[model samples]
Target: MNDLHQKELLLKSILENTRAQTQAIEDDELELLETLITRREGIIRQVDKLDQEMARTTPGTSKEPTGPIKELLRQIITIDDANQELMEKSVQDMGKEVEAVKEELRTIRERRRQGESYVPEYGDYREEGVFFDTRE
Candidate 1:
């Protein structure tokens, strides 16, 4: 088989394995992202090989690849781009969640500034010592 065909086959196989990995994700989204990146790297390697063979075999044949191979490569590029955007958004969302929790804690502290307080499990909160007289 020609190098171009071989590279295409390898890329297809990698894509299939990647899809399987993605489908296996239940709760850990990072696993899917990691597998996507790995698949992208494999696609890049395969495309590089295909490009080299095409250049060596048929010099000055159209720079743009045609047919199914071209479509598959385009899809791979799009997926990688999308994955990067999603990863960035996920991090930003997590930062926002943390900030929201901090805001809530700050509000609670401000409201309870004058009452008997207990130290937080995760941090220090000043305790107000007010002795109660129980003699009637």
Candidate 2:
């Protein structure tokens, strides 16, 4: 009876540990997502600034003349477009990571549901004891 109690306690401890680790990983992932969103927002603001600058510097075919500001504006626009594309790809990758994590969580839940019995779920382990190759 004591052995059974100890086994149960051990399983409970393992489950608790797993839950804690999962929670920590989830928190970290959330923080990373927030950071990504913040970065995207910053990029958007930069794009808006570029737009305003361009509008001020090149409203029409001004009789005066375009300066280095026009060239700089063009370069800024290119940079903004590239940054936007890169951020979009990063977001897509993050989404894939989220899905992978979710799948891992699902698998962990299933394994937990199966219980921590020493008996193997396949092969001749049900009757042949440890001599059986459970992997088969």
Q: Which pairs of residues collide in model 1?
A: none
| Alpha-carbon TM-score of each model against the true structure | 0.57, 0.41
Q: Report, for every candidate in turn, its global Cα lDDT versus the true structure.
A: 0.68, 0.53
lDDT of 1 at 85: 64
TM-score of 2: 0.41
lDDT (Cα, tens digit) per residue for candidate 2, span 1-136:
3322433343334334334433434455556545544554554565456455556766773433145444444554565455456556667888999999999999998898777555566845445446756794
lDDT of 1 by residue, 1-136 (tens): 8765776676676656555544444234766657766776777777787778778898988777677677767765665465456557667888999999999999898878745355566576677899899999
Candidate 1 regions off by >4 Å? 13-28, 111-113, 116-136
lDDT over C-alpha atoms for residue 126 of model 1: 73
In lDDT terms, how accurate is model 1? 0.68
Clashing pairs in 2: none
Cα RMSD for predicted model 2: 25.4
